[model samples]
Target: MSDSQLISDFFSRDVLLGDRALKAAVADRGEEALRLFIPEQEGYGASGLQIEQRLAKLAASIGANAVDYLIRVIRNGSWQSMLSAAPAFAGLREHKQRATEGLVDVLKQGEIDSQRLAIEALGYLGADDLAFCISEFAENGEWIPQRDHRRQPSRYHLDKFYFYVAQALIRMTASLTSVNAISRCLRQFRDFLPICDEVLGQNRISGWDVRFVQHNFPSRAADPLVRDWIASDSHFLQDCGVEALGHLRLSRTSAFLLSVLEDPRFNDSVRKTAGISLSEFADAGAAAKLAERLNSASDSPGFSWAFASLYAHDVAWPACDEFVEELLGQENNDSEISAHMIYSLACRGDTRAERSFSALNSQHLHMRGTGAIACARFNPESAREALFGRDEEANNPMELACILAAQVHAGHVEKVDSLHQALTTFGELPFLRPIWKREVLYAFFVAEGSDSERGRLWCEAALETPRRVVTEMQALLKRRAREVSANRLPRSQAELASAASRESQEVKDKFDVFISHASEDKINLAEPLYHALVAAGVTVWFDKTELKLGDGLRRKIDEGLARCRYGIVILSPSFLAKQWPQNELGALMARETVSGVKAILPIWHDLSVEELLRQAPMLADRLACRSSEEMSSIVAKILDVLKD
Candidate 1:
């Protein structure tokens, strides 16, 4: 076949023999076949989703085979061409020296746009040693925004360089010192790169990139800055700020968001932003807090917003269960503001929404679209008619992609033409791209198991998603690969039931936490810790509370030990020296040996790991929360564990 014909075959779905068709084509037709993808020749009309898939495929398949050609592409091609070719080195991480050298050479000599794309690829390559050198290169560089034929500037400006620098730095070195270093670097170089409109605190430093950084790599260092953003006068900034804090999902951040919902000064939009972000805190305390706010005479819709956020992520909490009846009582819930209540209850599997959903789904386009999305998530197969009924009615590409994804999420798919249509439309959605990518991936994986040609291609395509997402998909792929290798699970219901019958065992959890401590330390540690846990909405079994006058003390203590979800052992000098506490510790350890569940949560009070190692070596190995930390902080940590 001619070279153009070989390149033409790259876009042909009928030729999906395997993941490495590009590498195979290279073996047969030489390096010329790679040009179809590397520079991404024009006129094929590849959509956004297909382009991403091609990039990901090249990254996974090209490996070290095309390292020299890719390097030449970087050295000789335009910055846009360099950007197009960069994903290939991601596949070459194991053989990154040649790619890194080429990319770094671009960082030094190539244009600013080239430098930005190169540093990003370097971070992907895990090249940390070159950070300081790269820092020097960016120190004095000023951005001149890319322009169109009409001479209008692009969406992002020159200061975006700083944001990219910080992202690369964090990916290379994820330490507090590194975070602090980058924070200062931004301050020193850009003096707080504002949002150009998004404002980093010092002003608009084109912080759009920085926000993406915070979302993926949240740290305590950004806590104060994020708070200020939430407090800002601009509702837009406040929305961005609240979203950033939500990403952190710490107890203190949750507390701050609750305060925002409580405060009357903030506008409805800002309050609503605060409420939606609270979905990140899927803990009992957060849900209970929202429920408490609702039980009051207040009229904030933020509480329901928080609930739907949790439900959308597939998390359901008992704390939100009590509000379903109250949610049903709300009027005009089909309206945009109150729509969250509909999603919150529906996704939680509440039957009350059945009538409301039917009405909503049959309403006008806007309400029907909302209804279809919520219903699809609640019951995908049932939502089929609504999704497609509205699918052809809508003209928007983004809406089309969303409907396609909703259909996939609901366990339905389309013919090749529809799948290709989904591929084209998904590119229009930049932020929602990853989610839609997973939807396409799931659709493919279901139609063709991981061993099939299309399945391997889709898996390779998904590897070039965001770093955190890539890590998650890699773990899932590894696990699925292992399961495929063994293929030992029972196939029939009878076989599965027999296997399950052999392993049938159940344990009831009466308390969220059980505090075990010596009476000598009760006044200082145990009693205070007990009150704190209770205040944080955790059910605890303290001997003082659970041990009644007529109770069998030893038997009751044993019951508390076995029934609690987690055992908080207050390990101190007194606790370690006591015989009773040691016996209790032995019981918890025995439970682990039998069931293989790590249930012990240790709090070191006036005790060192070294001393504990001498007395009880087994307990010493488990990391303990230091008593010196604030009691609330300790309670927050325990709540975090319960959340997981």
Candidate 2:
């Protein structure tokens, strides 16, 4: 049959090839061919429903294979593609995991459209069990927005997927709301927070745009949703609702929100927000909680924001020793909150800050540096103990930076290291380079007027390190140091070379992924197929999932083929014309030959076996074919291979 005729037949009643034909098609062509038939086509009518029922029956017959095909179909298809194909595979498994995996895979892929599609499909699928997935994604606020071609300098980068997902959570699925309102409430807590406008600009007001701001504060002022949320026994959701009330900035919600703070059911975070929100309403009750929390044992750094927001600066001073002790425990405290807490302690200049800074050892660069800076600003003499440490880890660039800051602020020069290890060994993490940078600059200024050769080398090495922000600050410090230095020193070439080598080593080790797709066909189909392969012990190397931190699509594909078994190209029209996929197919074949394993698998949807080969001789040569006739056969194959 001609290609157009098959396309036409796909929409015809004759397309209902019964169970046997459906099985044959999937087994011969793969799941895409079976899924291509539009169930609601105009000509199929009631006969179409009957055909679908028969297809479902056939799918059940080869249930294991059907599951595999469903996995394949879900992983590859876009949100629209999933929406189109989901109903047929619903009865295949009621695990909730399959659907969640499909959505999470799309989100992880990081395509603006794919993320949106995944979110929208979650709503349409009407499965409440996937609510946690939605909540987790929403909390991250990392949704990347799609570029709009229609607008000149577009005003938005909305992910329609998330918007749809939110609507789905509220309107379509009862799993979250009905099963356990508490868990459901806790899951969406972040949704009510003061999200950055940058994050908000990603999603625009659509047809069913919910004025969540307004919804939290009804005009009648007695909405049950609002009331229930205010009185929810679940502390997590109540905390969120309190913040939601604050974000809405509604005076009407003040009483309801305040009432939550008094309820013993609410947690510390909720009571905190409730107090802050009620403080806006001048509710005397909120003031009491703030006072109580300030004096309470829960006065850890995590609640610094709540305290700061309430302008309880005086209350923060007493918690300094505890905060400093907690700070030494791990590098896990919220950076923003810790910064504020340290700053507050610095202003207090009490014995606690002095004792904390005095207790600093080489073992705790992060905490000692933080304490040193804070203490130095208030009591520079307190940093002398931390400054004298000789251990490389203890006397790293970060510790030196803080010690130097304290010395400069106090007008006292203590001990300065030679060559300053220009690449400070602070914290053992690459990402925390900036923190050490600040410390190094402060240390550079402290070596002023010193005749020591080590001081000169330290100055030169500090100048040689490369952080634009640190560089600019260093230039300013160098001028200040020149005024203080008894003898001027030129830049050290050996130190620069050593620093360059270390930076190069760090830069070269970055990770990445490679995606191969059929150009004309939708990306929707490729998503699930990629993920299922990943879940089924296949090391997937797709750009969407692999390269999260940066873009290295080509590099990733090449590297993946080098490391991965082989590439699975979705053999569609788009895949044929695209040079990337062709190149990938070539590489995959080469890898197969090298690895001595079947590499390129031809996955035909509606395309004939002959046509598929005609389109890509490379894929045809490498193709180790597997056919899926319907859901049943796909699941059967999956279970057969996936299970022992």
Candidate 3:
């Protein structure tokens, strides 16, 4: 059949999972094929592909040839079609008359998704002239859906249109750091601080995803509204503000959250959550302030105790060694809290950390088994022995799980193995207490990665574990994985490589592992790894075989790199020396935020952790499989993310 007929069929049919169907119809056409389709109720709403990746790839695929075709779809008034084709303008540097006009019409006449499309496209295409039209639509407030009062005030969720408009504005003026840009910031930070005074202001907060009123909000007018959602009992409402605060990391919030960290009015959960939030913005200034607070805070044990709940290694621990020692001597003697303090201090070269842990774990302090657990994070060599010695005693099962988590943080493979064997049900324990899953156990999967041996066990036990915990893990995994792309491939090279392949449409397709190796290791570890992956029923992308290399060899390899969710590198000496493989690894590392945060799983063949860290610091933090392990055991570890 002809291409026109195929495109017509795609849009006319109420196709679900259209990716597979489209791949069959025009395997060669790439994302350009999706645009050629005319209209259908829905074709590609939900698929295996992430919404952002799929949207981005489509925009990237639209060419001058498809501009007219896309315009036709926008005019066709299919919101689904408009969503796909509207982004065409984003890909092209040049504006087309017919297409630009059609999107404008959609903005004026269309409903939610359609209007959202026009707004985003205009913003992305940098349509300054039409910015007024989009702004007018937003200000008119016609899109706000009327709803009942059942959903509490300040807890109402708006459609994604508002976020799209805000994002569009950010994209359009991104080049300018002028006063106008600051003016356009629209009280994002203005209302951020008042929450310190209100402290979950009950009668005050009115709304968010709000009318946003105008381009300019009176600084404190937005205060109660911002404070309301931020302090909401609902996670969804709070996250809307929290995510924005974290991403913007405005200097305003650093002080605000720090104040929230110290305020006695807030409960432990709020204070600790604030501490974690403040930890994200931890700087020398913030650290110094926290330290000063620590020094002066002779009696505010709550301030110091909650601050130690998480020991992010990057935090520059305060020079308050005396303060920490003094706090330890007082009634601030919770074992778990003390353990986190010990681990964090030790990481920053505090000499008293080992001594602190020893006392905390001993009968003299009588702190529970928890101190050994948190201590393991910094010094697994010592924590592992203490953990094992208590195994014969009636130790807390949950507390032992905490120790294993500490070992996961330390990331010594031998020690990790020793600790896991001691715990036995390493994956199942932390999950039993759902609260700990967020507070304490997110470290378990983040550090080990959701594809490690422990992750595999976690996934297996997920069937028996509470659904909320499983859902939390999945969400956390995605959030941790998503970061800003620092992709190493220059645009020109990316254009000619796996990016431009026919498999560009295969955004949803994922293999278990792409065996990235230096060709030199095909004999020693690479070949065996490939066969082992295949034997374990893994969807291995070995590029078939080394000898089968052909003209499309680079393209095929690139496709494997792009398509695979995990890139298990055979990081041997030979692999480290090769420039192409290094670039491949760099590309994978860049996509860690864009694709999977823990995408690169290294196979340290004849490479020490120190050597790996020196050569590729990015991969060193990821839990790696060793080439020295038995092939079966290695593949079992590799399948951790997939097996469940």
Candidate 4:
């Protein structure tokens, strides 16, 4: 009956009757329910009609995901309410052209959330006309000003605003023919970089969300501005600026980053960020300098982070013997940083570290845990000793399960019994057991044993574990079954044959063509090629359309490559220019070399023959076509090869 009552009902989880009634009322009565409760929010002074209009605006926004409600409100609400709710309407692409005036009014208000939503809606609808509006906002206006403490935006409003900004940025980037529009917005916020840097230095944001500033940084944001940021008195700004620059992969920023790394004034996190930035910039000298900094025992933590960066990007950051000895000798160090040190040293697969890990019979649970994980990569025997619960003293079920999985990975038959026992004993701990349980069991089967009894038990247990855990269990069990029949470890000849057999079966099951294309050129060629193929009596597996469920995209692509009659790639100007496309082409070329399966059929779109020949000489030598009709013709050739 009132807003207070409604708010109270919203929060009261236990009041089932009231919650049900409120939800039902919202569903059934819609605007009528709000009119009746007008006194609650705005008091007796607010008229019923005005209350209805306001409630409709709030409803349209807050429950914007309810497409039906959004459509109804956009079509029926007053012009002002419709305008305020236009973004939600545009998301559904259900608004009439008349609603554009209403949307403009809301856009003019320059409320960050509204503007973001409007921009997002425009993008969702692919309304090219909104380009001018987005540019105007980027140039002349600001994101809704950060809310003051007393006048803070609601959480819903803030979330909506952030979501809109992310979507808008993506859309605006798409709208620009060149990087100029994106560059302009970034330059406008160039003044904020120091503030961003300062915030980062203070660790104002967590590592995961640091990408917010990083993603928004312009390609040219790495100018002398970064040097100014590092030299500034504000440590916070300098830290964040370095991290942002690293993420932007600005090689030009590496010299400046290296200089900062040499300075003792910069904190460990700042130095680490700079080191990683240097690696990204591909400054081999910077990597060597960072490695040199790791020469001392005290520099271990900084070195570990830098080492991780270098390792990821395939950079040559040598691990010094002194550092390796210091790390192996660090049994008494109790900080979480010690775990990082252990991980780094273990990553090197130094026989000394391996020996030290094996020799450690009674290490701290945490150290053993880290060592177990690290040793899994190389010496699974040491990993098992440090991790498996084979002895009564090695009774960390969590560590045991993990190490057992590692042992299985290393194909250590000796550790199979220990892995089985650990899984049975520790599989009840949701945090520890659920994930590694299946992996350890898979390893058990891989260790040359027919534990049909254990396999049956796990199969039953898998059905009851959470859905997230079940799929992994099923995959592991099926793999184990094939392994058992074939009588070989995962890496053995028999296992390889089984894998080939399974892959060949899957290929026969799908029997569709895999079309690979760069996302940027999706609109111009990839999208049409997929449609034309589907229209031309070919089953199509276009990633954007068929790979709608997000997880395992790369795996799906690989599977398709193995199974498909052919792989049709649209090679355009932007496609060849991008690293990801190059990677796909390289993979296809590698596959062809090994299998002699001419699966990849290239289609050249708008590229000169010479340009194609020069950029991708190997691909240019293959059968390719220039148009959709030509693409269809090439498909017949592919079918002929598959048939043969």
Write model 3 residue lDDT over 353-439, tens digit each, in one string.
Answer: 666456435652224444543354334456545555453453555555555554444333344443444444333332232323332
- lDDT against the true structure, per candidate, is 0.54, 0.42, 0.47, 0.47
Model 4 C-alpha lDDT per residue in residues 1-644, reported as the tens digit of each score:
55556644432322232334456557756755543332222222212221222333334433424444433333444434434343333233334243444444546664554455455445433343444344334333433323231232233443334334334433333223222344443332234333323423333233434343244343334432343444556565567667766654432344456566666788776776665454333233334445555444135224444443233222344645564455445566642234444544433433444543553343566555545554654355445455445334556776666556565555456765665566555534222222234444445444544334444334333322222222333322343334447553334324422433343232363756777788888887788777777776777777786665666967876766666666777888888767666556555654442332356777787788777644544355455677556656765665665566
Off by over 4 Å in 1: 1-36, 39-71, 92-102, 111-120, 123-139, 142-274, 280-304, 311-339, 349-352, 355-366, 376-389, 401-421, 428-430, 433-644
Report the C-alpha displacement of residue 293, candidate 1, in angstroms. 6.2
Can you write out model 2's per-residue Cα lDDT over 1-644, one digit (the tens) per residue?
A: 44344445433333222333555555655644544442222212212232334344434444445554544444565444444444444334444566556656667765655565456445434455555555445545343333221221111333333455455454332222232332243234324222312456532333224322122121112232344445555454455456545433333343455445555556666666665544332112222345554555244322444343222123323434554555333335444334434533444333444544543442445556655555544444444444444233444565554555554444344433432333333322122323334344434433442233433333332322233223323322322233224332222212222232332222231212233676454355567565555555545566666666776767765766666433445666666556667667656644432222344444555556676534432234333434345434433443343243
Q: lDDT score, residue 323, model 3?
A: 53
lDDT of 1 by residue, 1-644 (tens): 55455555554432253224555666775555556566632324333334534554566555676777766666676655666665445456667687787777776677766677777666555465566545444444532222221222233433546556656654443322232343343232232223223322344433365554443333433433342344446565566567656654444355567777767787787677677667544344455555555544135647665654433322234454555455444445434323445544444445654643563444334344445445654554456655655566656554454455455445454432355444433433333323234444444433333334553444444332222222222321222223334652222212212322223245688899889899998988889999988988999999999999999988999999989988899899888667688668667754543333457899999987677655544355466798899998999889999998
Model 3 score (lDDT): 0.47
lDDT of 1 at 576: 67
At residue 285, candidate 4 shows an lDDT of 35
323, model 4: CA deviation in Å?
2.6
User: Which residue pairs show collisions in model 3?
Assistant: 11-39, 481-597, 483-593
Against the true structure, candidate 2 reaches a TM-score of 0.26
Please report how far candidate 3 places residue 522 from its true position, in Å.
Answer: 60
Number of the predicted model whose TM-score against the real structure is largest = 1
Per-prediction TM-score, please? 0.53, 0.26, 0.38, 0.38
Model 1 lDDT-worst window of ten? 488-497
- Candidates 1 and 2, the one with greater TM-score: 1
